[model samples]
Target: MAEQPQEVDFALAAYREEGVWQVQELAHDVLENLEHVSSALRRFPGDGGAVGMVAYDEDVFLLVRVAGPTVRLLLSDITAADEWDLARDAVEQLGLPYPEEDDDPAPAGDLDILGDLGMHAMDMGVLIDDYDLYPDEMLSDVAGRLGFGPTFDDLVGLTSA
Candidate 1:
């Protein structure tokens, strides 16, 4: 069984309603599983549904975009499934096979998850492939691209106060 992380670096829900973006901190419990995260996101009244961003132990990140009955996912590193339950769950949800020990670290699932929101699949791939950036940095970039960078940064303590 894959081990779950003891703590989540951060988990946030970002949504837009009435043409304005609302960013809020998600409870750590919601990071227990992808289902919980999705459920939490559904409670938001975003015009295009809500998005969940979670980073665990500074090692991996998960993105869940819920729009009505449709749920799209993105795992920053497919290899994380070997030791993280959330990553394992994400792999299962994406209908992907488990990664072999030798598999190189790479992103798995919908690269186009945020395409309609302005971050194209190609760009997302490039961002995820950048090893220098931590999960928080990557997520910050996503929020910025989606027009809510500063808000997200502030919420996650990425901004210097």
Candidate 2:
């Protein structure tokens, strides 16, 4: 597994530009919880709503895209259960009772968020169960699946091999 940081690392707000994807690394302090995630969405001055990715540790990562009342979710570890504020806020955002997953890594919401963009459900399923990868790696997969692999790798400070 890649090294994971203890505190929140960094976030990226991604939006499509003329059919091409673009990613921008956000300030580390810009994200702390689901509310901050929502704030970032509201602050985006793009043509469409932007998706937010927050990686807390190797075991915790959150994918959020808010469109009005609906906040789509894709969490890496369901066991975080309030252990991390990011996870806690996600459950709150979805109004779901925490600690009820029965110890599973299955994602929380629509696995096919990027299905329309490029990723298929089966591919997203594989990524969700890949516990060996770190949060950044998982988010990298998400970005890649959504048609922004190289851009995501560059923005996340990862070099293509």
TM-scores, all models, native as reference: 0.93, 0.82
Candidate 2's displacement at residue 45, Å, is: 3.4
Writing each residue's lDDT as its tens digit, candidate 1 over 52-152 gives: 99888887899999999999999999999987888899999999999999999999999999999999999999999898999999989999999999999
Off by over 4 Å in 1: 1-5
User: Whole-model lDDT for model 2 versus the true structure?
Assistant: 0.71
Tens digits of per-residue lDDT for model 2 on 35-67? 767777767654456788877755677778765
Which candidate number has the best TM-score?
A: 1
TM-score of 1: 0.93
The ten-residue window of minimal lDDT in model 1 covers: 1-10
Backbone collision count in every prediction? Answer: 0, 0
